[model samples]
Target: MSYNSRTIDLILKAQEPNQKQFTTFQQFFKSNNPPPLLFEKNITPKNVKAQRSFSNKTQDSIKETKRKSLSQLKYPEYRMLKIYARIKPGECQLNYDKQSILIETNPYNFDRVFEQSATQGDIFDIVAKQTVDDFLNNINGCLIAYGQTGSGKTFTMFGESSNPGIVLRTFTHLFSRNQETIYVSILEIYKDHVYDLVSGVQDLKLKEDLQLGFYVDGLKKIKVDKLESCQELLQIAEENRHVAETKLNALSSRSHLILTIQMGKTKLHLVDLAGSEKVNKTGAIGETLQEAKKINYSLSCLGHVIQCLSQGQDHIPYRDSKLTKLLMDSLQADCRTSIIVTLSPESKNQDETVSSLKFAQRARFIKKEIRIATQKKTYRDLELEITQLKQELLETKQRMSQTSSVSQFQCRYTTDSEIPCTESLRLTYRSMTNENKENYLPNLKTQENNTQLELENKINQILVELQGLNKEQSLDNVKRQVAKINELTIDMKKTYKVLVSTQGLNNNQLQIQSQFIETQQEQNKQLQKIAEQISSMDSSKPSFNIAINNMIKNLQQQQKQNIEDMQSKLEKVYYDIKKNTTVQDYNLNHLALKLVASPNRQQQQQQQQQIKRSQSKTNINPSVKYLKNKK
Candidate 1:
């Protein structure tokens, strides 16, 4: 068949889906058909975009990776004091760039500058977290915040309960990140004398050890295994910390607080330096004036040390101030230190701000070399650790004893069958403590047998007393007599409860008590019905009628009170039905998120059988305080 070129193309298109072979007129009759090209140069398809090459994509990815690497903080190979500055908010204007702050014309640079708006957590993430992380890798580190009065140095280092500062965060971070036993020593320098904040030892002397540098002699070093222990120490430190009010700032830290945390071989020193203040501007007098002078001189001494370190002077003056003396090792060039320079943004305090900047800028020049602090554990630390272990073992044994007692009690007493039977009563008697079984079980058995009879007798006596009321007696006298009888029944109930709680009644006694309560309720209802019947029969006699009416009202009130009391007791029994169920899961949920979740009951049993773990080493009730603080 003959066809046009368009028709031949159409014939090929029509057969594209069927995949059947077809002899086209073009292939069949054409002289020659050229082969398709293998490759084309820059020939764009109709309505199509060009694809990017793999090399270009790789180049773009490499650029992004480089950008991220530049921004991210890497653990420094050489340990040096890194200076970071933070600006305090005020009415006056202060200029700043990415890592530098300006005081009018003079420009000062730092490793990084945090604006006043940065949160406590933000500061911790960029500053303390890295130190803690590296400390775990066995690097000794020190962090200090230095600034003038009312410059937010204390606030940055030690914040409110709701907003935890860096020190608190560091404690928690170290505990969470490490399994090693940590030793914490807290102290403060108040007016040129050192005082142990933890033990409240006044005028503690600083001593230099061959292995340990600048150790505080007789400074109580406590082993803190948990954050709560650290918190308790911090709380004690805060209470003992010398603080006073001034015109410049209220509750100014009068003493420089230093917290030394020992993790394995490495020690992290967290220092909250006392505010550097000008006595003239702060309006100080007497002791406050003396304190200011001492603080300024000590800080000046520290500045001198920093200046020498920055200038690479060989004759380093370490004994200039007691503050510097205590921090001799931490101030060494090998120590990995981070200095947070807090500044006042107020234009009025421009000079103090400039001075703080100068201190930090000098710190930037002091190079850090890695120091290996592989000191052996002390005798005191080992003794404390041993004492803690013993206490823990005792607690564990106590818990195991309680759990065993509870389990045995449940297995013996908790049954689906009825407990009122004589055989079951005998079983309960057998389950009692040896002393109770010998002394009290027989009396309980006797009471159990006679309980129904006694209830019956009381009911009969009540009816007889009501029916045989003396006609000659005054109404008041009869009412008083009736009240006395009701009081007797209440006394019996009180006695029964005392026996149940004090003597540790068996399930037999409890079940009997439960029955007694039920029977008593029924008896009250029956007594009410009897009173109604008697009142209905004797409505004709006016005097007797009035007495009976009062009697009925009294009886009703007593009945209601008795019913409520019985109901409360029964509800208490009901509440305690699930007592054997472990509440650790719920209790753990009530605690802070940092607390470890309770192990499975089976796992606990296995652990109790195996290694017999030690109890908590610290005295801080972290769960209680954390929840309280959170609330």
Candidate 2:
């Protein structure tokens, strides 16, 4: 049979009564059925009862076994409900049933219900208002709408034609508040690819270098100035969303969408994940099948991560999938986070509802410190303001100098110089007119006054230029200091790298030294063993003499060789120490000396040599031996 046929048969057999027997039958059939048995066509009720008695007992035993298993089973601590239905019109309703506006809808009614309710102040308005208030208060905030596909997740998040979406409402509120700085970056993670919906060409051609990982440890942030721009960006992203036809709905999102809003220092991440669907229900084919598989794998990994976290397992498998890994920081208890779970209330979607509910329930147990970190303006803005002030001051100073120069020129002609010349002076000048002073007096006075005024203006201009030069010089000094600081920073980095390398080298050297010490210890043990062997030999007569002689000779040779080697190593060490007597080198020398000493052998050799010398002296005397024999 074909592989597909075999797979189908296996599935069918798995569902059969007497599963073990069915499996056996399947295996036998696969093996071409080596033997077959035919049973009796009919039996009496009494006979049947007798036959079934044994089976009944077995069934009872099996039931008891099943009961034990049931007893051992643990109920889920949290339930995750995954909504998987579409929002069709007329399937849901909206009413102010609860204190807050109540939206009663299944997946089918989501879009229509959201349209009608959003017109009357929907959940988006509530969340947006809260976010705006938070923004104004210098607190960081986030509002995320989460739900399955075709469940009006998109519509609720971003409403239909008559109503604006959460994103639009948020910006509208933000603009209205006008109290914070906002930047928005819209992106879609489709097939593990991040695309910039805004700032790219209108042709939907994604820029090659514009891709960003959806879950980056350090994501670049965008700054938004106004709500209109944010809304425009959102519209662009919506256009870029990857949509495809599925069995359930057309325009089904094929990728996860993330819209990030950065307000000053705080970041708000609004994520709309693609609805998860079972492959059999999706009826996905070809590339869609592959895409579905990847989606399911990632989603499953996310589920596992959630499960592990709920269980307080130390090993959360975030690294198993990109999605989980990216969410690591957000999921951490330190990060202030809130999850809004949207669900389809349809009874037909019991499984999806349960899954989504369970997910929400698990999320409820996750205790996070919900602190809204308000973004504080950095020094850069202050610096810019200071620069602008300086420029204005300089301009004012220039204008003041020009005004002073003009006033000085006007003053030269005013009051004192403008006074009418005295008649007496005119007469005197007339008397001396022929003698050369009188004829040019008015011209000389005018020239002198002009020269004086010109001098004063030059002095004032010089002072202004000097002041400007001083300012320039001061600026240059500041620049020099900044450069010096940069150089120092570079040097510090270099020093840090050197320190790190040195530390690594030190650790390695320590390890090597430890190993060397261990080897020396082993050698010392061996040498002790050898010494014990030599001592044992000394206790034996003939063997002791021969062994002692051989050992003495070997020792003499070895001592000579070792002395030479030591001298060579010492000379090398001496030179090395002279060149660079680091603490490490000194330690090495001491260790080397400890290895060369053999205390036991040296003492024994000295004793033996002394005895031999004494014996030789006694033998030379000769009379001693004879006298000793007579006694």
Candidate 3:
């Protein structure tokens, strides 16, 4: 019999005490086939007949049941399957349900109906075993638990019993096999920030400088040793996970939790994503609302990634969210991946279940080739070995050359008679030296004296030439100094004349300014007297007073205007002198003109102003002050 039939038979037999009723089950097993059991037979035949008698009731019921089953199959709504054991209000229960596949009770405890339920095994155990086997074989696997709020995805993936979770089981298998070295790294990708959970402990004092794209772009991978270490890392990450209570479920995860296991060249990623739910349904508020938004965004990004992978699009928006980016490698062709979608088995969550199944169905079409990273030795070791070999070769060549030289010396000594005839001629000359000494001595003495005299004459001529060159150098230096002194003296005389001319101009300008100030003071006194006379004659002699006032106003305006014009002219002159002084003849002519013209112009202006003020005073009306007082 098939596993399903055997399990059904076992459950039926356990429900009743009689062995005879179970004979039917045995006969069913012997036939190796069993018809679908009809629960209507358990209902009274009278009641069935009464129901059938009521206007095609039995046919209608059958048609309705068929239609419902067909609709469910045709739509094939997705669901997150959660198999969990929990303690209910009054009893313990193991909950196994799929939202797309309806079940009867709310707190359906497996322990309550352990004998009645299927006996072969819980589906979770079967799936977990298959996943663990895949992990051991170095195939990248994913067990994703996804569902609406309050669905038992977490409980199914992580069992409450001491046997540990699928995560712990997979690690144990890795440790036992010893076939590959396992490195476990844990991180939480929330709101685009990749936080290292293992390194943040105060005692362990792991640094926070863990980069997001340390090992691979858009993937948060950390290198760790051993499965136990990974488990600890996972525990740390669990503690750090962002969770909040919702209306449907307490302690609902607000972020996707991804646990990555790298085994030798293979990587396995297990993701537990937060379920998608309506804000109204979840009753999330404040911070919970923000978390829900992030979760939804990440889940949407994951959907986009799956869709992109299915279509083989060039750009997969993995970087759009932290959760997607962290799975960049796995989502692509770099690893084998499997998605285990979890769902709730409640009619209320039918919509969520349908969406989940549709997403999974689309994900099934994605084709990702398994890419294994090839291992190679590091270059540093190879470079060091090469350097050492080169040094040894050089030393060997040097030793060989030295040995060859010594052998050449020995060979020369061994072949002494092979020396040239010049050595024999030298020996014959040495033997005849005494006889030839007397004959050669006189010629040698004469030749030596001639050579000595020639050497002395050449030395004396060289000394005389050196002395002449030294005297010429000295004379040239003296002439250069005299020329420098003459240039300096000329510059000094010119500078002195310029200074004397500047001093004389300054004295003349001071005298002229003093004289102009005296003349301006006299003009001011005359203007004051004229102003008093105009005020005394103003009322009776309107025309005369108007003329006087006009004259005073005109004189004052002219004086003010002249002073402003003179000041502007002086500024322009000084500015031009400063700017044009560097031109060769411009500075000398500009200085002389300024010194001669400034004083003479000031004296002429003083005389002109004195005459104008005297004339204006003579034209003043005497009665102007008396008229003004009466008005």
- Separate clash counts for every candidate: 2, 26, 20
Looking at candidate 3, the ten consecutive residues that score lowest on lDDT are: 107-116
Tens digit of lDDT per residue, candidate 3, span 1-631? 3435545544443233256656765565457563234221221222323323432444444544553343334222222122222211222222444222223332222111212132223433554455555555444555666556565555544544364556766666667654444666655555545555555422111122232232432334556556656666667777777777788878777766667777555567666677787888988788888778877888888888888877888888877876776666556543445455555545566677557656765676676553332222233433454455455445434433432343342334333233221232222222233445334334333433454454455445444444344334433443343344334333323332343343333453344445444445645555555545544442323375356446545555655554444334433443444453444333333333233233366764554454344435544222222212422
lDDT of 1 by residue, 1-631 (tens): 3445654455344223233233432354243432112112111111011112322344455554553343243444654678898887657578887589977687899888998788899899987888887666666789999998888878888889999889999988887866567899989999999999888999988888777767788988799888888899899999999999998899899989899988656778999999998888989999999999999999999999999988999987888888888777788844578999988888888888888888988888887664443333344444554465455445434433432333243344344232223333444354444554455434543544454454455445444444334231334444454455455444445534533453356675577587655656555565556545554453325666676667657666766576456545544542353253235422322222212112255653443332212113223233333333533
Among these predictions, the greatest TM-score belongs to: 1
Off by over 4 Å in 2: 1-120, 200-223, 312-315, 333-336, 372-631
lDDT of each: 0.65, 0.48, 0.49
Query: Per-residue lDDT tens digits of candidate 2, residues 1-631?
Result: 2234454354333223366655665565567533122111111222333334434455555654553344344423321211112232444433422222232442221111233223315565544555555444444444444555455567656766477766677677777755445677766656665565665422222221222223443233467777666666777777877788888658777876667776544455566667777777778999887777776677677678777877777888877765565555456542334455555555555466456546655555544443324222233443454455455445434433432343343334333233223332232233332334433455434544554454455445444444344334433443443344334333323322332232333443344334434433543454455455553442324464465456445544543453344335434433444345455433333332222222355663554454345545433222222222422
Candidate 2 local lDDT, residue 437:
45
The alpha-carbon lDDT assigned to residue 536 of candidate 1 equals 49
Give the root-mean-square deviation of each candidate in angstroms.
Answer: 36.8, 39.2, 41.6
Candidate 3, TM-score vs. the true structure? 0.39
Q: Judged by lDDT relative to the true structure, which candidate is superior, 1 or 3?
A: 1
| Consecutive 10-residue window with the lowest summed lDDT within model 1 | 41-50
lDDT of 3 at 389: 45
Candidates, ranked, TM-score? 1, 2, 3
